[model samples]
Target chain A: MAGELDVGYVAQLARMHLTADETELFQKQLGDVLHYAEKLNEVNVEGVEPAAHGLPIFNVFREDKAKDWFTPAQALSNAPRQANNLFIVTKVVE
Target chain B: MTKRELPALSIVEVQDMLRRREVSPVEVLESLEERINTVDDKIGAYLTRDLTAAVTEAKKTDVALPLGGIPIALKDLINVEGQQCTCGSKILGGYRAPYTANAIEKLRAHGAIPFGRMNMDEFAMGSSTENSSAQLTHNPWDLSRVPGGSSGGSAAAVAADIAFGALGTDTGGSIRQPAALSGVVGFKPSYGRVSRFGLVAFASSLDQIGPLTKTVHDSALLMNAIAGHDSRDSTSLDAPVPDYAKNLGRDLKDIRIRLPKEYMIDGVDSAVKTAVTAAVKQLESLGAEIVEVSLPHTEYAVSVYYILATAEASANLARFDGVRYGHRADNITNLFDHYARTREEGFGAEVKRRIILGTYVLSSGYYDAYYLRAQKVRELIRRDFAHAFEKVDALASPTAPTPAFKLGEKTADPLQMYLADIFTIAANLAGICGISLPCGFADSESGKKLPIGLQLLGKALDEARIFQIAHAYEQSTDWHKARPKTIAEGMKRAGKAGEL
Candidate 1:
């Protein structure tokens, strides 16, 4: 059942770096979870609309108004790494 | 009042005393603080506490307000300004909430003091609090067993009398399951009933913040303070907020309660079935019509929930890439490596498992087959409840398959843990309200008394009906009044464990 999906590829897609042991462990567990989820295929969903939300809310718009919000200091207060009032991340293209 | 009696008082009782000046706010806070110091070591219900802040808030308490001086615990997932909001995950360790959640603001506006931060499954992921990286929250009834989660700490705290009432988020039975296991009242309001403005998002569509309390009346009281529309949350409903506590004592003479056939499966525990069956009979005796209903698509609830929840979770959790906030992997040479290693080290196993499953299901080739199909089936599941509602005012079922199992029993198998939420998940998927309250108790093989829960579900925005039925059931039975013995009482019997 592990052959149903590639654990390595999915982990990469999720931006998670799994070690060899983790990959092996997750492969089996994910296989079981997905296998159990295969029961969904038994239902006939022809012409059924996909429900993106539980309610029938659509196009919820609010008036564009300027309101007082969190300042830069408050926004950056929880940043793990901050420099010059800006969040610091590793350079993408150097 | 003595500190020993403080934990057992309900919100209504505490409010009455506060109104009479019989117990000051500071006295109430001190009593809970003392109780937590005494029993928290055994129960492990709180993740963090700001007693100093709570004391300050208590000093300013105005007893004239509706919820004046009531101490309520906030599940770590909900932000309280200037307090630690860990979401019970290492990824968010050392992070402080910049502002208060909408519900927290409402609680404060009504004079409810946010006393302590309760533990939960990391980001509300697993059914059991075992997935929490911070600490294991034990069942107050039996410390060896789990308290059901991701709101395990909230349920445990309320059950153990640490908090009069607490708030919990139910993405997929997180609140109700734990509440059921811990012998407390766990309510999940309709999806849009409460605003999600500052509550940490698990699965945006399914996530709802509700109350775990000692009585259904307290749940309604808490709901009155918290339920309403908030402009900050786009999905928040604009409907008129009902006084949930107003119609609580109403009779259920004309109410039609449905028993879903699919929920009464053979795999369910005999004790759970028997207790819930007896509770249903009690409902019938109280002058309600018990009608047989069929939710044929109930079997697909777990399958659909896992697919849809993980898919939504994958996207919702992508913000924890160690860029702006939360844990940052040290010694990172590049951006991609930073993101990869941070999540790897920060998240627990179950979180990673779901993230991977979510990624796989939403991937290009598998999108239509997995994510889209699950969403379509989810529609059918929602329709099943809608049709059932046309015939009955509410539905009744067992909250969990069994009483609390041993801590390590289901951890090895994720599917088994998922099955524990089999009865509670459908309500969340359908965006309806549900409650888990103590119906009866079942004895374990060792003769330890474990509490069983009976879940009552209502259609969307029909929480008042559920509350009426639950309140009626709770009033007729003494199950809600049954409390677990303190850790000291249990230790006196065994003489080996419970050394804090």
Candidate 2:
């Protein structure tokens, strides 16, 4: 599909692997999606403001304070592999 | 009681039995186990059923929790403290969550036992569960057909009697559409009604969590248990949480339901139209003033939803870099290889497709034209709903364009799958509340019985009125009582039952 972005690098950056067939399949699908997205280009935003939400979006943050949480053991219980209160994983940055 | 018979039990009935000691929590949990074991294989409704863990929890509770002894299904996207949270993809296959979602915490506090995780579309992207990339959850009524997806497993699990109710998230039609297809009640509350603290994100602005159950009253009960202002979820609503279960089954003599003319356009199946029209008549007979309205921008909802949904999904799913968590590729030649291989290995075809589409739309020089514009269209769609509410109390439409389609029928074509959600997508795009209720049934010339759902959309936070109309409708009809017999027949082809 023409004008399709080569997202291969980003997919790789995200630890995703796409086969040649999938890459090709996605290129077409993504291109079509973007083509359809071009309808958004028709909207006039000149002198119009961009709003984050239709309704007011407020930061409903809780007061910063100490709070109790489950012990590290409980949190790591579902990790496929964990060691010494940390989730074990392969090295990323060399 | 046979497990088959147990699927028909309402949450209130089950809880009442528990309160009276007529059914022990242990016995209820055991029956749920038997039901899950018996039907889940054919329906593919559950990812994991923690029989031992649920039993342990039930045994520990000498005094029943409010929802104790009541079985419930959890959508796989949410993290359960010690259960695998796959998000219906291979990438996070066998991945367990370290902490429970805040909503799960609330359910546990209310004594709800998590029966198991239900299936979903991979990363909650597809309108059908076919994208699960693990198992295809057949519609409980018709094993050969799909249970509407992303939350297909949860919908099927409840519809097939594996659980009295289930929790599912909605990005597009993940919850409501599946509920419609599966012959159950599914509600997607206004965004942030339920906390999103632990749900795997597909589209943040569009995502919501709600109940899928056998009845409207059950959904209301579950919503009351889970809906609240949670500090952990920034988008969580600070509005006062109403007792959703209050005023359920009330008279709707003054309730005005608007039938949007835009939804009844060409391409809708004849049977779906017939069923929805019949349902409208039924609603009219019960005192609802049916009015005609127009959502002029309705035609563009799917396009806007796709763009915005993919863009947000692309950004939100970036955490699975194979390094931080989930499947990682070994022997990485470099950082790029690790990312590519892990994502390739971890995510399935559908998830990857959305991620790529999202990346393209949000990429440099494309952001304003794609993401920004879609968001604007999204605002317009919401305004359309708001404008119509001035004319009526709620909007009604067919939940899907048609009944459940054959398995593998549209999996090869992503556009067809997206189109299946054409009707329900508008609700999610607008962030309004909507519920899909089994209103009627259709008989194909081949003599197959398929359930048709009618969707009731209410203004944001107006779940009470939606439940009122749905419960009233169910009382006037026996559609909810007509369970699909094919679930037992495992009868290879879709089967026919007495039609509504």
Candidate 3:
């Protein structure tokens, strides 16, 4: 069951680097959790609709009018690296 | 009132005194400051305090307002302008909120002073505060045990009388479970009843902010202040908000309460069963009808919760990529490495495990098998509640299977810790409101009396009915008035020790 899923691939997808020990540990833990989750297979949910939310809410549109919003300074206040009121990130094309 | 009695005063008592000018807000703040200075070292309830600001705000408070001059502790997840909102994770180490949450804005408008920031499980992930990267909050009842989590600090603050009432967010029983363990009143309003704007999202679909207080009436008062529609939150319900405090002291006659047999199954502590069973009997004596009902999907609640909550969490937590806010990795060579390394270093073990699990479940091949199936099962769980409500007004169960376990007891096994919320998770899955309050005590092996909680679950948007039932039961019993022995002793010693 553990071999059915690649822990490293999932970690890569999650964008979380894992040590060798953590990878080994999570492989086993995730397998156990997945095994437990397999119990859902027994329940007859053949015709049941998947509920994304408890209450049904739809088309929650607001008027397309501009209003007060966070200033660039406030938005950039917590940025780890910022310059000229712009977020600094690793260059995508280098 | 004496200085020692100040900490024990409920919101109602404190509000009345403020209105009548019997006690100035400064005096109340001073008393609470002294109490927190003395007892908070032992409880670790607060992560940070803006005492100077709180004092300044108290002086300007309007005496006639609903919660005027009342200092309420805020769970760190809720934002307050210019204050640290760590959400119990090191990733947010230096992150200060630039604006206040909608709930905090409501609290401020009602004249409630948001004073101290409380501790919680990191990103609201674990069931114990031990997962908190900053500090460990101890149970006031027994220092050796946990003060439940992820709102552990919020519950501990109210239980130890450091705050009149505190705000806590419930995503998979975070608020109610801790309140149960800490022997305080915790209410999780129905989804959308309170605006989620500015709350640090854990699992967006399941998270709802609520109150933890010393009394059910205080919970209702807090709810009245926080519950309403907000255009800022698209999901916020447009339903008319009721004055929750108005329904209190009402008789519970003709209200049908259901006791689900599935909750009383094996693995529940005998003492917990005994206490909740006795509470049901007390409710029966209070003129409420008690009927045995079954939510057949109860056994699948925890499983379904983990899948849906973590799946949503994985998506919700993706914004913490180290550039916009939170900790950033140094010496990063690339963008992908930056994200991976920052998250790896920022999140704790339990958080990482959930993220990994979430990522896997939502992955392409496994989506239908795990995530989709869980959502469909979630609908079944919701339907079970709907069918039950057709016959009964509310459901009752033990909030947790047992009293507070010794710290570090379940930390090693994530699965075991997940089971601690067995009875409470169903309420979240069904998106109903639930409240946990003191019902009785279970004597530990050392003869120490640890508190047990009786949970009353209500249908979606029907908090008024549950409040009436909970208030009636609470008034009939003296459990809510029972304080932790250790806290009581600490207060006495503080009285002798003089003001800080």
Candidate 4:
């Protein structure tokens, strides 16, 4: 029931690249893990509702009041590089 | 005090000395630094040491606050201003936090000295610290084996006596599992009991910050120091923080302890089962009654946890574009290229794998099948715990199936790594509170001994009762007095033979 999930497919999905060996290794491991998870399919769920958060669901809202805010300079002070009230980095748009 | 000698001091003893002025904060800091220098090489506990700043901070604290003058190691995820908050990742290798975590700021206001950062699984994703991009932290008990993690460094550091106590974060058993593995006391206060303002999110809904120490009393002391609501954290509960230390030594004469049948399944290591059963017998001797209970849906906990935790992680990690303070790739031409190349270069394989699985679960078409279904199952798991608690005062179980395994033993298989947290994750999934303490030692067939832990689980805001039972159990057992042979004998060999 196992098949080769190519390195390019994983890389494309993960948004990264890996060497051939790393790809082969991860492919085998991830596939094995998912197959194990599929073992859960053997269980029967009749009408059980999934529990998310512990407390009863409630809408937590604060009054819409404006408060003091950090200055652009202060907020951007720890940026590796910054200019003109913005964090500067490598060119992104081709 | 030698490296081994310091690990045995109770937090209260350290605080009392600071109050008496018999030992200056600088002296305590220096002693811990000496221990770290001598002990950490064997344990690999500390990730960053801010000695100059710590000494400066200690010098400033001429007067002790409640927990002031006590040395504690901050988990790497917490942001301490001007110190690197690596979160045990290569991506944020040199990234120094611009501001301090709200919890750290509160600790400073009360005079607690920040010793350094501890290692963890990268972004707190893995249960074992093996996923740490930095290095493996060895169990103080046996150097070849692991200390439980993603907060493994903090747990090992405290276990080795490098510091009196240390702060660690838990999301799916990071704190308790490691504490159990290392033969120390680890407590996770009720979610929202402590602020999570600066902890790097692994699974936000599941994460809670707590303490690891040598005793239940010390764990409660640190909880009193750190537990309170903060306006900065929207999720922080607005309840009053109680004086948890007051009930530490209370008698648990008639407390009803529940033994969930689901937890005592086949496949639990015989050694761990024996230790936990023995711990229950000791509790019964103290007049506590043990009752068998059922949590029928226990088998679904791990599956539900992985789906929900990874889904959240996928969303939480989207900010690391390499443009924001983390590592960046060279010659990135497009936004997609920037995200892809930077993350490719920055993140470790485990981190990337989680992101991919997380992304898949939350993807447009599969969202309902995986993510939504997991959420509903999570609700059922919580209800299961709640249903059982109605009939008992608290619940008990072995914290993990086995003690700390050797490094690289489970790293190859992610499922095997995930299984390390099987027993502890249920509490996180249910959003209840739990604590782990040394039960006894498990005798290995090879004549090596490993520590086993017994977990005490309680309902929301009932930490006082949990502490009472844990303290009572500690009072009746000598298992906690046992430390690693290396640490205990290392001090004697080094000529610091005052106490063993």
Highest DockQ: which candidate?
A: 1
Error of 2 at B119 (Å): 1.4
lDDT of 2 at A88: 69
lDDT of each: 0.90, 0.79, 0.90, 0.80
Instruction: Please identify which of the two predictions, 1 or 4, would achieve the higher lDDT against the true structure.
Output: 1
Q: Report the lDDT of model 3 for residue B272.
A: 95
Question: For residues B99-162, what per-residue lDDT tens digits would candidate 2 score against the true structure?
Answer: 8898888888888877788888888888778888678888877778888888999989887777
Ten-residue stretch with the least lDDT total in model 2 chain B: B490-499
After superposition, candidate 1 runs with Cα above 4 Å error? B1-3, B486-500
For candidate 1, write residues B54-168 as lDDT tens digits: 9999999898898999989989999888999999899999999999999999999999999889898889998779988888989998989999998999999998878899999
Poorest lDDT segment (10 consecutive residues) of candidate 1 chain B: B491-500
For residue B98, model 4's alpha carbon misses the true position, in angstroms, by: 1.1
Compare candidates 2 and 3 on TM-score and give the better one: 3
**Per-candidate interface C-alpha RMSD?**
0.9, 2.9, 0.9, 2.5
Q: Rank by lDDT, descending? A: 3, 1, 4, 2
TM-score, B chain alone, candidates in order: 0.97, 0.96, 0.97, 0.96
TM-score of each candidate?
A: 0.97, 0.93, 0.97, 0.94
Q: Provide the clash count, candidate 3.
A: 0
Task: Give Cα distance to truth, residue B82, candidate 3, Å.
Answer: 0.7
Ranking by DockQ: 1, 3, 4, 2
Better of 1 and 4 by TM-score: 1
